[model samples]
Target: MTSSEPTSTRRRLRRLWLPLAIGLVQVAGSYGAYRGQLERREPDALMVVLALIGPIALYWLRQRPVLVLTATTISTLTFMLLQYPYGPVILSFVISVFSAVIAGHRLAGWVAAAALYFGHVLGRIALGINEDGIYQSLAVGAWFVVMVIVAELVRNGRERSAAVARTRKQEELRRAGEERLRIAQELHDVVAHHISLINVQAGVALHLVDRQPEQAGTALAAIKEASKEALVELRSIVGVLRQSDESAPRQPVPGLERLEHLLSRTSGAGLEVYKTSAGLPHALPTSVDRAAFRIIQESLTNVVRHSGATKVGVHLQYGGTFFELWVDDDGNGVPETVVEGNGLVGMRERATALGGTMTTTRSPSGGFRVTAHFPLSAEDERDPD
Candidate 1:
């Protein structure tokens, strides 16, 4: 907690000084009235003045609620023992009870109120104020009971407000967790896919320089394309994370329609791929399209990095309510030493978030294969783009 924060003493006094000051004035007026009612109207100069300052002193320690209540109770009992009338002298003690209850000291407040009320009544009667009448006695006790009830109500409201604040904080934390997972998935897919392609194309350029000088240009061109796309997508991710209002356009994340760009780069890495898409190429939802593109991009990158596959096949099929993706390569199947990697986990998470499934297995053609199926919403259609 910083000194400038609201919890600091200066801020707390600013917020609560109003009610305490009002209560102090009320107590002072009550003391004046009690002195006027007595036969010996001369104020017992010391106790009367102490009663006036007692509540104000307690107000300064409003942060130490229990101490405020306890001190006020002692002061009130001392005033009564001196044969003081049932007067505004007790008003400060009531305010203390309210303070303690509102501070979540409910049990202590109730116990203090009970003890002080009886003590005041007993002291008044012993001093002959009760002999005045039955009506006066009933009225004094009733007022004391009302103060206790009011304090309890204030405490209940404070507790309810605290409960609501706690619930809202928990909800915010849950949303933050989901957003962090999504960002992590995005970084893994973008970096893994682009870096793998660059690594393969660079190797191709190096190998062909001596034997096929002209083809090296093609490999370098593919590396350039892959790096450019990676930069754009990474920029979009950064724009989403930036706090400033001034930002670059980040909409339209990559989709399967842009899959040819990835394929061209993969081909440059010396992988021969046969691609087929059935049905008209109607557009898909950004979420579904992005996931599909990333899934394919990752699968091909894995093939280049781990599968040692030279020839690959990719199939895309659209249906009324769902779309399917399949990628297979003719290579020495998935190696037994291979383990599930971050790319595979990222792809599966993306599919599941879109209410879909992604699966991978050893293909019948003696290579690895990956399949993804995602349900489509009406929003998936993008006006034939």
Candidate 2:
């Protein structure tokens, strides 16, 4: 058998032991308590059956709380009406009432407690059993009220704990979803940018192989460099999924600090890229820096793959409160009916995730232009030097 079978059996036994023990206590304790009250009715077969039935019904309390409460209440009231000596015979009834309340059956628990208390008092009055006075009846009423209040308090605590657990689970699920989206964006940026360069250089190499074999060698070298960079980036992104004991990739993440390297790689693909900066340059928040780099990278990739232009201009404007990035190409712009693809959507998501805004439009030079603005916090304005 599987290991779970034994564990399941143990759990069942643990659940059963409590009610069984209480049943035994009810039977034995009532009989013992009855001996001290010689003036009351002597214990008989009916009393023994009544005491045993209440605790037996308790075994199903968790599954059918209201039914168990009803059964135990009837048995206990019958025992009281018979003028049997007062004892621990009511223990099963008390346990069932508390279980009903804690299990979210407040109405059933309250009604059952009221019926038992009033039934005992009225039954004694109807039978002309005046041995106990009104003070005893009032005292029993007060005790029942206390029991209900205590049960209500315990139920409230359990409900609050359950709500907190549900909220925590939802928060964890939300964070996991966001992390997956980030990884997807990273993979898309790395694969799309490098693959576009490789495709362009391969075409150039094929075109010059027989005509200018020396020019073909340059194209082949560019292909090798692009592929090597792609592999390094792919390894770094995939390393996040590896086991904790495994060594993580030590490659630095690409940010605006590596913009010159990115521009050089683009130029190798036979595109004339011009970069310009305005205003004072300062440090940026890590998130904003990475987002700025990826946005520019994706924009350049789009130009190489779709635009037939030979000249492209990249500009960075560092302002006091907002950092601006613009990429313009002297190529045929996108058609108005063209739908946004994954590359464009991923770029927008990256920008928006860092409280940045991006826009794409036709430039004055009859080419496509992408512009983005990222707001800077006070800490980002400080110079690293």
Candidate 3:
């Protein structure tokens, strides 16, 4: 069988003490307020015992709110019918109503509380029991109304608390999803570019070692450089993912300044890349800079793997308010029905995330082409749909 949640000693005592106190007050203590007694000396012990039973039953009010209220109402009516002095057994019924309302059982609690109040009055009249006065009935009715108002207020408070908890949970999940995506994108960019260079250079080293030992040394040197860059980037990613206490200072994100390193690696892999610019080189915003680098890196990696091109032409132009980028080759172009892969998707996502656009198609020179544009003006973002 399953057990309840573990409760602290203090909490367990608090849970027990209320019902115990209510039961005690209803039993022996209620006799003091009663004008008549069963005998000359002592109060009616049987009546006291029945009153005690009503309040003692309130222990399950939270978990079984409806059942507890219904049972308390029945027991309270039974005691009243037995001609017992009123002993605040109604207190337990009131608490059960509040609990049931907050527990999302408002209709049942209201019905039970209403029945409890009317039932008590009906039982008193039907049994021909003497009540204190008309004023006593008013006081009892007002107290029942007060309990209902309190129950509604408790329900409102609980609903607001539950709504806040749900909002917090949703925000937590959203941030976690974004973090996972960021990590995946970073790892993909790092591994794809560096591993492509390393693979190509390793092949060059093996091929040239048997013929030209000098060319073999150059290939080995390129491999070392590529591996070192890969390790540095991988370590930075590890630092990014480490627990806060174990986290190291982060390396700066790759930007256009790293363009030279990318060009060198591709050059060493035997793909000559020609660069052209229409404007003076200038610093770019962090978002645009990183997106631009990843786009070019993925473009070149794809060219190496897919395009049987000997050379690539790269152009960068800054036309006052926007930056235009193009990477085209003179080799077998991509198929007409190009299936978009992760690299293509990542390039588009990076560009769009920075309020830019990217396109890929077969170039006029019978080679694949990647083109992207970035807006230098913040006006693009400020425009409303």
Candidate 4:
């Protein structure tokens, strides 16, 4: 048998054992009680049948709680009225009350318990067998109250457990959504930046292959380098999906430390690039550092793809509370009706996700400019040196 087969068999046996055990207990206990009672009527066929009715009804209590409770209550009251010796015959009735209450049938369970108690008392009085005093009645009432309290507590505990399960499911879904967004951002940054460079170099190689065949080698080489870098970054991003036992790519995550390599790649695309920095440089939070790098990388990619500018400038500002990134190119400025594309949207999302802000507008040099500001935590502002 498969693993699940044994578990299923165990569950079936678990479900059956309760009623079976209760039936045996009632049959044996009632026979013993009958032997001890000399004043009550002697054991008869109908008495044995009545004692078995409640336990039989209990077998269906989980599936049909209200119906089973009714059946057990009637059988129990009839047994009491007939003056059968008191014993474990009422066990099924008690189980049914708890089952009904826990099945969200509180009103029915309460009424049934009250009816059994009052019915026993009233039935005894009507038959002129009211020998038990008020103290006995009060004691029975206290036990009934205790039973109801315990059932309510079990019901409350089950409800709380279900609520906790629902909250955990929602939290897992939320984390899954965030992870998807992060992967999308990473793929976009990796593909867009490198592919833009490769595209430019490919065009240059084709244009010079016939007239300036000697210079075509340089363009072809740039294309090869760009494609190699793209593959490395893609592997790094895709490594997150690997199984725990599998080896992952050991590439370091891109950050401001890789700014020179990014600038060189952009310069290779035939753009004259200048870089400048202000304020003291310090180690940044990994998230802020990565976001800043992506914003600048995407901005440079947009310049190469859209702006025909031969020159671009990148500026970094490190402050006590914030890190800033700016990229401007001296190409045709953005048209008034130009719509933002995925590259720009991804950059904005990265900045905002890190509690930062980004803006895209036409620069004073008559070209498009992208600027982003990322906040720094106290730890990020600390000097590592």
Number of the top candidate by TM-score?
2
By lDDT: ranked, best first = 2, 4, 3, 1
Q: What is the lDDT of residue 211 in candidate 4?
A: 97
Candidate 2 residue lDDT tens string, 1-385: 9999999999888878877888789878878987898888898888889988888887787889999999999999999899888999989988998999999999999999999999988898899888888898899899999998899999999999999999999999998899889889899999999999999999999999999999999999999999999999888888775534477576778899899999999998889999999999888878888889999999999999999989999999999898999999999987766688998898888889878888889988999999998988776777422
State the TM-score for model 1. Answer: 0.82
Q: Please report the TM-score between candidate 2 and the true structure.
A: 0.93
**TM-scores across all candidates?**
0.82, 0.93, 0.85, 0.92
Instruction: Give lDDT tens digits, candidate 3, residues 1-385.
Output: 2344445555767778888988877765657646554522244767666676656677766667778777777877776666655556566666777778888888887788778778877777876865547788778788877888788898999889999999999999999887777777878988898888888889989999999988899989998998888899888877768744565545578888888878877888899888888986667777787888888888888887788899987788866678889899988998889899899988888888778899999898999999999888755333411
lDDT of 2: 0.90
Between candidates 1 and 3, the one scoring higher on TM-score is 3
Question: lDDT values of the candidates?
Answer: 0.78, 0.90, 0.79, 0.88
> Which structure is stronger by TM-score: 2 or 4?
2
365, model 1: CA deviation in Å?
1.6
Stretches off by above 4 angstroms in model 2 are 1-11, 243-245, 382-385
Extract clashing residue pairs from model 2. Answer: none
Model 1: lDDT of residue 312: 95
